[model samples]
Each structure stands twice: as structure tokens, then as C-alpha cells.
Target: MNHFQTGRVSTNKNYFLMFLGRKGDSMIEQEIQGASVAWFKIAELIARREREKALGVCRLLAHSFPDRAYELQLEGDILWALEDTLAKDRYTQAAQLYEHNERWVEAIALYEHITTIYPIDYTALADLLFCYAMGNAYDLFTTLCNTLLHKTQTGMLSDTNYTTIMHQAQEKLQKYPTSQHTAWVNDFILWAATK
Candidate 1:
């Protein structure tokens, strides 16, 4: 039985509204309509191993909100649990959506996984570097900068892109200095400027 049917809680929306007393009517409505509750329900079903139900909810959510990255991610999660190869593509699509929204941290988390499987993916590597720099993850940025520098020297990374990335990295270093990497960055900047 449902919580309300079991006499453990009221079915009245007012009962829940009491907890959000200061949130106002519109806020409460928005919170409900925003799919936070539905997402939680689906997450609970997934946790309980109700795989079919969770997949159904995921498909419904993705269909209802085609532009929502989280919905696509949720659908991908369900598909991944079912061992579907297309799940990876779904994840990439969701990551692209995050990138378009300029949500660097989220995009980086996904790109990091994708790049591990496709290490020579320069496009993903480049975007991942940008996200690292944007998030002030200086240590990761330093590592990626060195990798790009190596690639540039080996003619793997394009000269034009390398110059652009090096300049961006130099500006990032100046904007958010890292104590341990300072000398390395300085040397790279000098090398990059000369090239």
C-alpha cells in the first residue's frame, strides 16, 4: 500500500506544504512540477532494483523533457544497467548538452570517462582542458597542458589550436596561480610563446 493508504501520511498536499511553510504557493508548485519528486521516486525504484519500473520512468522523463540533460543522463543510467552499448552514446549526448550550457564541472566529469576509453580523442581532451581551467582545477589543468604541449611538439595537436590553448592556459595560470606548478607553467609559457 502507499504511505497514505497505510495511514502513515496524509494524501493532502497541504500536509507537505506545512513543511514548506515559508516557500510560498508558487515555490511549492514549482518544486512539484520541476520533476524533483518524480526523479526521487525513479531513483528509489532503481535503488530497490525495480529495473523495469525505473526504466519506464526514465523513458517517460526523457520524453517529457527532451532538453533536460539530467533526464537523458537518467535514461542512460538505466540503459547502462541493462548492458546497452548505446548507453555510452546517450551519456555523450548528455555531456554535450552540459557543455553547451557551460556547466564545465559536469561536462568534465563525463568527458573524463569518455576520454579514458578514447584517449586519442583530441576534441574531448581540448574541451576537458577548458573545463579544468574554467573550474580552477589547476593541477588537472597543468597535467593536460603538459600533455597538449607534448602533442603539439609531436605534430599531433594542431599548431593553431595549440597556440590558442597555450595562450588560454597562460592566462589561466596568471588568473589562478598554483604553487607547485608555477615553474612548469612559466617554462611552458615561454616555450609556447616562442613557438
Candidate 2:
């Protein structure tokens, strides 16, 4: 059978074994092992640019093991791969996938994920900060800004550019005076300014 069919069969067998309270069933164990092998095979297909086959296998695995961390991670990896190979608009689809999975932190992280391989990633940083603020994760927001400030001090970031971005974010925060969340953002900006 194809990887997708194998995954589905394994998933059904696993559920049946669970319902029967038969934890030591060799048949079920083998099926689970088969599913894991299929999952890896799908990952290989993805790496080989077999997009349709990879997606089919990944979809089956995702449905079969909705709460499995490895499965979720693989799905995210697949989406990221598609994002790289396709247009920028593909990122929106990946973002939606994270949202559908209710992986809010991952979704936000994806929206703002960055690498220093490039000169600067101000847009990613800004989106990350905004995501933290919008989620009311004040502690995280503070920690992120503090880390960025430290990086700037260590010369990892260009001081002039960092300052300019901070100033703009602060200005934007000031415009929403009535929002407690904005107040928190303003407080963080002020604290960063003093340091």
C-alpha cells in the first residue's frame, strides 16, 4: 500500500487496540511502527521535491496523530518548505495551518521567524514584537526587547538602526493611549530607552 493508506491503516489499528485495552498486541505495535516508517518516508519525499506525495502522506499522518509533537513538527517543516519553494503568498497558507492546529505560539513565531544570515531582519523583529504584544504576553515582550537591546550593545545590531526602529515603535504605542496593552508596550519602550 502507499504511505498514506499505510498510515490510515495503522491509525485505525491503533485506535482499535486502544479501545480493546490491549496494549501488548504485537499486531498493533507493528502497525504503529509502520506508521512511523511511513512518516519518515513522506519526509524524504518532501526533501526530494515530491510535493504532492509528501503532502498526501503528511496529511494522513497529521490526521492520524493530531497531538503527536513529531507529526506537528513535520507538518510545520513541510509548510516551511513549500513557503520557500512557492511565492510569498504561500506563507499565509502555512500561517493558517498553524492557526488551525491551535499552535498560537508557533504561528506567531513563524510570522516573525528570522535568521541573521541576512544583514538585518527588522520586519521579522517588528512582527514578533507585535505578536507578543497582541497576545498580551508582556513578560515575553519585555524579555525580547531586553535581549535585542543587549545585542545592540554588543554591536550585533547597528545602533542607529535599532534606535530608529525603537523610536518608531514607541511613537506608534503612544497613539493608542487608551489600550492597556499599548501602555505595556510604551512602558517596555521607556525601560529599553533607559538602558
Candidate 3:
């Protein structure tokens, strides 16, 4: 080969090797693959009251990351800020994924939002109660249980499903080792029995 051609080829090969041998390549790849940085931009757009642009980004995010609950949740939050009822639908979808994955904190937050949007949504209430028990948030569970009892007194949560949810909670508590409800679980079951 000519001298100039040989030098150019060697330089290109060195550049390629440097790119391949770069440290933290996997970390760079993870940053590129993760959604946090993009979500931050979208959040900034929302904070700036650029709802339309933020909403467009939210839709794109949901489409690109279909399996992740956080994407839909962001969309739902934007919709809520816009006072759109479709927020609930998006929140419901996200909540289902979170619940299915046993991500109790995210599911609980979404379910709480759903309940505020629909205080009489018995299914959401049941789901929230189930999450509370599973997460071992006994204080919250007991407080909500009393409120639910009052709701029943007002003929609000009078359906058979409430009783079924109670039974489900009882069954969940009955599960050994995994259940942290070692001490007060029996009392909770008794409380359900009286309901």
C-alpha cells in the first residue's frame, strides 16, 4: 500500500479500537437504554406548562416503553393536570401492571389516585386494602378498614365483593413466612369476620 493510505488505515483502526475499549461502555449503554433522562426532560416540559409538548412526549414514551408502568403513569399525570378524565384510564392500566408485578408502592399510589377520582369504586378500594395488607402497612389498613366500615354503614360498600376482599386478605395473611403479619394478623382476620 502507499504510505498515505497505510497511515489513514492505521488511524481509522486505532479510532475503532478506542471506541471498543472505552471504559464503562456498559454504563453508557445502560444510560442510553434507561428512561430516566428522557423522563426528566418531559417532566421539565410539564413544569414549564408546556402541556401540549409534554403530552406528545408522554405518548411517545408510552409507545416506546409499552411494558413499563411509569410511562403510562406519566401520561396519566399529564392528563390529570389537563383535567382530562382519560387520566383514570391510563392510571388504571399502570396500576394493573404495577399490581401484577407486585410493586406495592407504585400500585398503592395509583390505586389511591383512582379512588379519589372514584370514591365509590369498590374494586379499587379492595385492591388498595390488599396492597396495604401485603405491604404490612397495618396502621393504614386499620384506619381504612374503619372508614370502610363506616362506608358500609352508609350502605356504600355493601356489596358481596367487600366480604370477598376481606376473605382474600385473610387468606393472604394466612400464608406463612412471606406474610409479615405474624402478630396482629389473627386480629385482622377476626375484624374481617365481624364485617
Which parts of model 3 have CA positions greater than 4 angstroms off?
1-54, 61-67, 159-161, 164-195
TM-scores for the candidates: 0.49, 0.52, 0.59
Q: Which candidate gets the maximum TM-score versus the true structure?
A: 3
**Candidate numbers sorted by lDDT from highest down:** 3, 1, 2
lDDT of 3: 0.73
RMSD from true fold, candidate 1: 10.4
Q: Candidate 1 residues 1-195, lDDT tens each?
A: 755677857555655666657455787568568677678878788677787788787777676565777766777777666666766777788887997797878888987876776676556665676567666677887787777777888988777877665555455446444544344556767866675
lDDT of each: 0.70, 0.63, 0.73
Regions of candidate 1 where Cα sits further than 4 Å from its true position: 1-55, 61-67, 81-83, 148-195
- lDDT accuracy of residue 29 in candidate 1: 67
By TM-score, how accurate is candidate 2? 0.52
Clashing residue pairs found in predicted model 2: none
lDDT of 2 by residue, 34-86 (tens): 78888788879877978778868877767656555445456556756755534
Pitting candidate 1 against candidate 3, the one with the higher lDDT is: 3
- Clash count of each predicted structure: 0, 0, 0
The TM-score measured for candidate 3 stands at 0.59
